[model samples]
Target: MKFSDIIGHEEVRNEFDGLIKIGKISHAHIICGEDGSGKSFIARELAAKILGKTEIKDYADLIEWKINSGKKSISVDQVRSIIEEVNKKPYEGDKKVIIIHDADYITIQGQNALLKTIEEPPRGVFILLLCETMGRLLDTIRSRCQLHKIKKLPKEEMLAFINRKYGVLEDKEIKSILAFSVGVPGKVEDFMENTALKSIRDEVMDTLVSIKNMDYDNIVKCAQKLTEYKELWREVIECFAVYVRDSLIYKETGKEELIINSDKLEDVKKLAMQFSMNRLNRIFDILNFAKSNMESNVSVELTYGTMLFKIQEV
Candidate 1:
């Protein structure tokens, strides 16, 4: 996608263009943000401009235009291979661009191997690095590259983007999805693409309601079923968090805009009634904690079971 096509981050695009115009483009740039926050998109946009490929569709041609191009994960060999490409004269234009998506995944050895090239890249060699966590990068690498922090898009902007691209969604439903998106347009788009996410959302709400009513056996059964798809639990936790958060907002504002579960408000209301605000707040914290633990390689079954038992208490 071109910089103009990105839905949010106008200022960032402007600043990036300014750097390019002023001939102050750093040899390497680090674009940092949470997952699905458009880090990789921005990298490719810059790469396209540097490489003189104007049309978004032309990005696919990169694979054939060069000896080799297209998306490739960061690896030690990949980093080493870039040196050979950069050393050559630019073929398409004055600039040769290389994008290392998920740069945080680059091994320390890869970063060290890349140090010399980044320190003094060949003429017109632009390196773009996309990562969810800046802390994962080496300090030497961080010091050498320009850093850009991409925050979540505003809720209204995200909603408009989803609506503009996907056609009509109920205003209320769009707003709910926007709330759940948490400022990440990519994640927002993912929700649109994955129809199963909706079903999982419904099931999570059902399971939460079951918990509030002290349906112990049912909650256990639901948790067991959830353990079957370990990858989904993170999504489920985020969806559930947004679902309850919006209910609290609805309770305060009495506006449809304040609710994220327009299609399932009855279940939301039921659970909101059964738990105190203090307890709901704790549940949100626990959900976030559980998500963190799950990512840290904690046993999914034990993690989810403990989470379920606590939800049942509520």
Candidate 2:
């Protein structure tokens, strides 16, 4: 994609532009950010600008290295082959651009193998490593690269983005999306493309609203049901956090504008009226606890069950 198409992070773009214009290009570069924060897009945007291409596609001088299909991690063999290719002169452009996707998934051996190239590549060579987590890379490797980060967009930017691209959507839907995406531009599109993600959101909201009156048997069933979405517990908890947070906000201020779940205003109001302020705060604590436990590798069922039980108790 074109750099103009990208929103936010103008400073990083400007710095990169200056680097290219002055021919002070760093040999190794790291583009790091969270998932759906557009790290990959930014890397390609830079690559396109460097390669003088309007679109992101394979170019003779642009080498794309990603994990192979069905592969768990990038192998040393792949790294060696790419290194060999880079040693050769660029076939098209004056400089060679190597874009490594999912750089964090490179095996330890692969990283070590690629270390020397990153430290001292041939003249006119530039390497872009795109990673979701910088900790996965060796300190020596990270220390050698010029790091560029794609940060989350601010609320105003995100809102303007939605208005520009999805202006036809109702205000309630826009507000829900604004709240759900939480200032991540790429996540707004991800939620639209993944219909099942929204399904999980609806299920979470419904289960949460019903949890207060559920009998012990029903609570267990609900927890069991939640465990079925093994890979999506985080999304489920995020939905819970958003809805509950909005409910608490609305209850305290009686200001609809202050809350994000405007589409679910009736339900939010219902929740506020049903629970005390103390209970609402307790539920937030429970959600945070469950999220921490899940991230720590706790059993999913136990976390979900405990969260529901504590929320019910409060």
Candidate 3:
């Protein structure tokens, strides 16, 4: 994809284009961002431009590395192999490009093995590292690369992009997706393609409503059901958090337009009446904790159980 095809980050696109035009590209670069925030896409686009190819995979000079299936970390052997390949002359293009997807997955040993190559590659070698965050990488490795952070698009830009790419959606539907997507196009696309996501969102709302009066057995069942969606726990918690925030907004202002979940006005109204502002804030905190814990590989059932119990208490 061309730079213009990217939805947002115009400044970043322009900077990369300018660098390419000046022929002053760096030897090693890190493209860091949240998952689904378009780091990989931008890396591929920049690589294609650098190699003068329409597609990155079609360019013979490109060497890509990622964590192998069922593998937790990228082994040192993998990094060494890329180092060996980059030491050779380019096959087709003037510069050989190495892309390491999920660079955070590279173990300390692996990063050490690749450190020299990144610091002083062959004359015509360039490397791109894509990662969710720089915290997992070594300071030495990070210090060697020029870092660029990718951020989510603005609300208006993201809305326009979804409308242009997909068919027009209702304003409320668009807002609903945007609220959960946090302006990430990949997330918006996934919510659009997977009808089940909407269903799960509805289930989250239902569970929230039920938690107000649920007995211990029912609470256990609800937590168990949520565990079944462990892979989507992040999105689920985000959706619930938004719902709680919207409920508070509606309660404080009595303005339906001010809330994100406009389509769920009735539910919002019911929840606003049932919950005080302080309680809503507490519930939001609980949901946020669950989301954070999920990132740390916490037990899904226990996390949900704790959140449900805390919300019930609130």
| Model 2 weakest 10-residue run by lDDT | 1-10
Residue pairs that clash (backbone atoms under 3 angstroms), model 3: none
List model 1 lDDT by residue over 180-234, tens digit each.
Answer: 6778887777777877676777777777777756566776678777787677777
Error of 1 at 124 (Å): 1.4
Candidate 2, 13: how far from true, in Å?
A: 1.4
Local accuracy of candidate 3 as per-residue lDDT tens digits, 1-314: 55567778877778888999998888899999888888877888888888887654457787788898999889999888888888989988678888999999998999999999999999988999999889999999999999999988988888878887887888778867886677788888888888868877888888877778999999989889878887888778878888898899998999987876666778888889889999998888888888888888889999999889989998
Off by over 4 Å in 1: 1-3, 57-73, 172-176, 247-256, 262-270
Please give the RMSD to the true structure for each candidate, in Å.
3.9, 3.4, 2.7
RMSD of 3: 2.7
| Model 1 Cα shift for residue 47 (angstroms) | 2.1
* Ranking according to lDDT, highest score first: 3, 2, 1
Q: How many residue pairs clash in each candidate at the backbone level?
A: 0, 0, 0
TM-score of 1: 0.82
Task: Tell me each candidate's TM-score.
Answer: 0.82, 0.82, 0.87
**lDDT per prediction?**
0.74, 0.84, 0.85
